[model samples]
Structure formats: C-alpha cells, structure tokens
Target: MSNEAYAQQCNVRELMREDANSEVFFQKYTLSEETAARLESIREMLKDDIAQANPLWKVIAGENEEEVYSESETSNNDDESNHNESQMMHDQLVVPSTQFYFTQTERTFVETSDTSAALPQRCDILESACESLERNNGRLDFVQLENLSNEDLIPVVDEMAGKLSLKGIYNLCASMNNMTIEQKIKYLNVLCTHLLLPKIIELEEPSRLLSSAIVECVKNFPDEIQQFIFVPLLNAELKDTMLITTIINSFDLEKKAILLEEFLAYVKELKSWHISILQNFLSVRLDHNMTDKITKLFSGKALYYSKDKTFGKLILSFLKLNTALSQEQKNLMVEVVAVNETLFKRPMENILKNM
Candidate 1:
C-alpha cells in the first residue's frame, strides 16, 4: 500500500482500539514521524470535506477560503481566473433572496343602524306599558318599578310614588323638558307626593337632588302652567314648603301673591310649623282683603285643634310685624290674640305693642 493509505488505515485501527478499550484500560502508543505527518494531512482533508457538506460551515469556510486565496494571490503570481473562481465559490454559498406573494381581498362596507331611530316612540311605549300593567291589574311596586324601563314608567310616573328609586326619578326629570303640559303636571304631582312633601315635613335639609329638578320644570313653564299645574299641586294636601320659597324667590310679585293665596287657602289643615315658616315668607303686602282669610287660620276651631297655641301666637305676631298690614287688619290680629289668649297662656303685651 502507499504510505498515505497505510497511515489512514493505522489511524482508523487506533481509534477503534481506543473506543473499544476506553472503559477497560487506556493504552498509549506513539506513531512514526512519517505516519504522524500523513495522518495529520488526511485529517485536514476530512475536516474540509465535512465542513463543505454543511450549509452554515460552507458559508464560514467560503469566507476563510476567499481570505486565504486573496493572501496567496498577493504573495504569488496567481492568475485572475483563480481569484474569479474563489469569488464564484463565495457566491454559491450565499443564501438566495426569497420573494413573498400576497393577495388583498376587496373591502366590505357594512351598513350601521341608528339605534335611537329604531327605538319605540313615547306613545308606543306607553301603550305597551299600559298593557303590561293591566296584566298585573294596574299595580306597580318596587320590584315592578325596577324591572320597568324609564320610558315605560314616565307616563304613569305618578303611580311610581314611594317605589321609584332616586336615580329613576332623576332620569324621568331629564325627560321632563320634552313632556307635554299634562305630562309634566302629572310628573310634578308624583314628585310632590312621594319625594318633596315627605322630605319637607320630615324637616330634612332640602335636597337640591329633589328640589332642583322640580324648580327646573316649573321655571320653564308659562303662568298658565304654573297656576294650573304647580299652584294646585302646592295647594294639595301634601305641602312641599321649600318649593314655596323657590316660587316666591323665582316668580314676579303678582304671581307670588296669586300662588301664596292658593297655599293660604290650605293653611287651616297644614302643620303649624309650615304655617309659621310660610307666614314670614309673604313677599306681597298684606291688605284687608287677605285679613278674613288670614284670621280664619286662628279661628276657634283652629285654636281648639291646636296642640301648640304658641305657634298660633307666633303666627299672629308675624302678622302684627307685617308692615304691610293696614290699621284695621292689625286690630283684627289683636282680637285673634285675645280670643286665643286663654289657650296661648302668654302675655299679649308684645302682640299689643307690635300692633
């Protein structure tokens, strides 16, 4: 065999022996200089062959081969054709650029619906709500109020008294601007019955939460609506006294007198505290025409039913202090004090002096 072939065979045999006996016992041996040199050359040839087989190794090896070629060409008189061959190898090892293809679909235009326009009108909602309530015998309770929508409850908002939530009442109030006169009348009536009067009578600090909505409604309407809608509601058995202040502060003097008289008409039945508070709020000047109406509040039956005659005296004092009262009305106030003096159990000295 040639010396190179023999060296290759010996290297293969030595490797097999080392792997086979590695765990049992390691054996050391030396090769001749000629065999070692030949074996090292064969190893370099095998390394190049393995590297060229791998794509990544081919790229690294290609760069190294180009550099070696450049140095060899610079040192030696290598032909231009050989340098071209090295560049060709580098190009062959390079990864090719890939082209991507995409297809765009046509854009679709969807028709969006207008939800507000699709909503049922107020009349239709009322009719449906009426049918629902009729099925339950025209009754509404807290649970029913919770389940019903605002649009359904607005028409029958009066029946929602004491059952509706404050948020629901406010939601209804927002819709009041769009309400007809009759609708607003009924709404304010419900508000008085359920929210405003109870709070006023209980002496709760007037809630802007409740009063603001009512004031907004009333202030927006004309005199006829005020008289026909608000005055009667204020005069109704349930009195929201704070709203009286709202009216007196908001309306002209003429309208204030008209509305004040409406409230005075119900004075006999009102709580004494309401009477006292309201008497001081009179913005219009007192005349003899109002005396009969005013003195009637301190009538025999009024004092008889009165738990607090001092309230009656206080009310009388308010009348005496009225700079607007004529001398004749002042005498009538003194006579009311005299008639109630036994029940009042207080000196008439102040009442007499005020007169």
Candidate 2:
C-alpha cells in the first residue's frame, strides 16, 4: 500500500511538474472527486515539462503538412478517429522528458536555459517516438518510408540499442546479417548507446553490407566512442571479426586520422589490451593480401612498433601482400600521408575528386 502511494506521488509530481491547472491532472492521479479537487488547487505549483503530450498533440500535429489539425477540431473529432492512442502512451514515451536522458547537448541546453533545446529535440525525440510507435504497431507506415531516406539515422540505431529487449536485439542482429549497408544505417538510428557495442560485434563478416555500414557510421563518432566502442570492438574481434574487407571498404583517406586515432589508442592501452587487439589486427593484416594500404596508412609509425615480435610478420605481410585493392586514390592516400599522421580532412576531398 505504501509503495502504491509512493508511485502515485511520483506520477503526480511528474504531471504537476508540467502544468497544474489542466484537465489532464485527473487522468494522471486517480482519487475521489474530493481529493482530486484538493489536488487541483496545487496544480499551478508545477511546471510545464510535466505536462502530458496529448494536450499538445494537436498543436504539434498542426505542423503536419497533410492537413491542418487545429486544437478544437482535434478534440471535437477525437471520438471519431479509431486510432486515438491510449493514455498509457506516456509510459512508452521516451523523449521530450529530459529527466530520462543526459546527452552532452541536452545537458548544455538544459543548464543554459537555451531555446536551442529544440534543435537536438527533433532528431533525438523523433527516433525514440518512432520506435515506440513501431513496437505498438502504431500507424508508422509513413515513418518507415520517411526513415528510408534519412541516411544518417544514427539515433535509430542508438535507440534500438537502448529500447529493445536483449532478446529483440539478438533477433535483429541475426536477421541483419543479410541486410545491405543502407538498411543497417536506417535501422541504426533506432538503436540505443549501450547496445551499440554488441551490435558492432555482430558485424563479423567484414565484407557484408552490414559490416561495411557499421564501419562507415562509427568513423565519425566522438573521441570517447573511438575509445570505447570502436577500439574495444576492434580489440575484441580484430582477428575473428573479418575486418579486412570492411577496413578496405572504408578506404576513404579523409577518415584516416579518425581511423588512426582509434588504432593508435588501441596500441596505447594497458599492455594486456594491446596484447589482445594487436594480435587480432596483425592476424587480419597478414592473412589478407593488403600490404600497400597498410604500409601507407601506417607510414613511418611501423618502424617504431616493428621491434615487437608480432610486428615482423605484419611488416613482412606488407612487403608480400598483394596490391590488387590499391587503386589510384588509395595509392595517393599512401603517398601523401605521414606514416602515422591521422587522415582527418583530405580523405573527403580525395573521395570527392575520385567521384
């Protein structure tokens, strides 16, 4: 009974946090009419963030281009549309509730009282809301097609990592083994951050469309991601992960520094970590005949590490590995880069020039 009352108070606090005088207050806190009236007196004490989204739906839906749904018209027609979503939609609602997440940008927006809060809100909320809609079999046909073209759908992948039960993500990872790079990216924007690591592990076939997409997407993640997600993933699977072709496919010289930072970080970890990842990275390099790109990308840096016993074979692999994959642009990438310099900017320009 005490737990139940505590839960009720929590709900009331959330509702009151948004706005106090609204009819939605009744929907949130159930009680005898007398108690409800007393609760109503304190409604104005709360802030607007606690307000339920339903009250604001029509206003936001007005932004929908298909037809203008005014606040009054929506309320009047509410009973007519069979698709009126359930009130429990709030439980499934993930975004717009800043209480739930603490992304760097969201933190900045909140602490500064910046109106630019709306900036990150669109990409961030839309992704979670879409997933919630998908799980409920909500009317999301338009969303599916709309997302098909949202190429940089990182939030989707990130949300999927967060929202899906482990069992669901397992199924998705299995099924995604057969998808294209584009499909994976579309699906990626829906994943959550925690799950991104395991999903990266699932991309084992370096040549598969999914693996290529994973490599392409993370190539630009913030520095921390390179340390945690990219480096650790490479460490975990460098030998077993089938990364040869995926890295080869990632031949965009412009992303090399971001790429190199990841590799260098891999080498700088505790000796135990370097021991694990370098073994795998070296094995893949040796087996795959990719000497030229490896040599060029590693340039002068190879000499420093070559003294390590494992280094000899990889260096030899460079001397003997085939150049079948080295086209003109890759050769140019090799020619210009300092042996170990990060290739951050020019890879893009080079890719564009090639195109």
Which candidate number would show the highest lDDT if scored against the true structure? 1
Q: Which segments of candidate 2 are over 4 A away from where they belong?
A: 1-192, 202-209, 215-229, 237-239, 243-248, 269-311, 317-355
Candidate 2 lands at a TM-score of 0.27
After superposing candidate 1 on the true structure, give the runs of residues whose Cα lies further than 4 Å from its correct spot.
1-155, 178-205, 222-225, 228-230, 233-240, 265-270, 300-302, 305-313, 323-332, 339-355
Instruction: For residues 1-355, write the lDDT of model 2, one tens digit per residue.
Output: 6999999999988877677667775577768999877766545433233323444433342334333335446756775563445544654575556555667667787778765443445455556554644452232222443433355345444555556543444344344344456654554434423465655555433335445434544454334344455555645544334443354335344444445445654443323223333334443433222344344444444445434444433433333333334465345434433232233334423443443
Q: Write the per-residue lDDT of candidate 1 for residues 22-57, one digit (tens) a residue.
A: 854444566789999987676565557565454344
Best by TM-score: 1
Model 2: lowest-lDDT 10 consecutive positions: 336-345
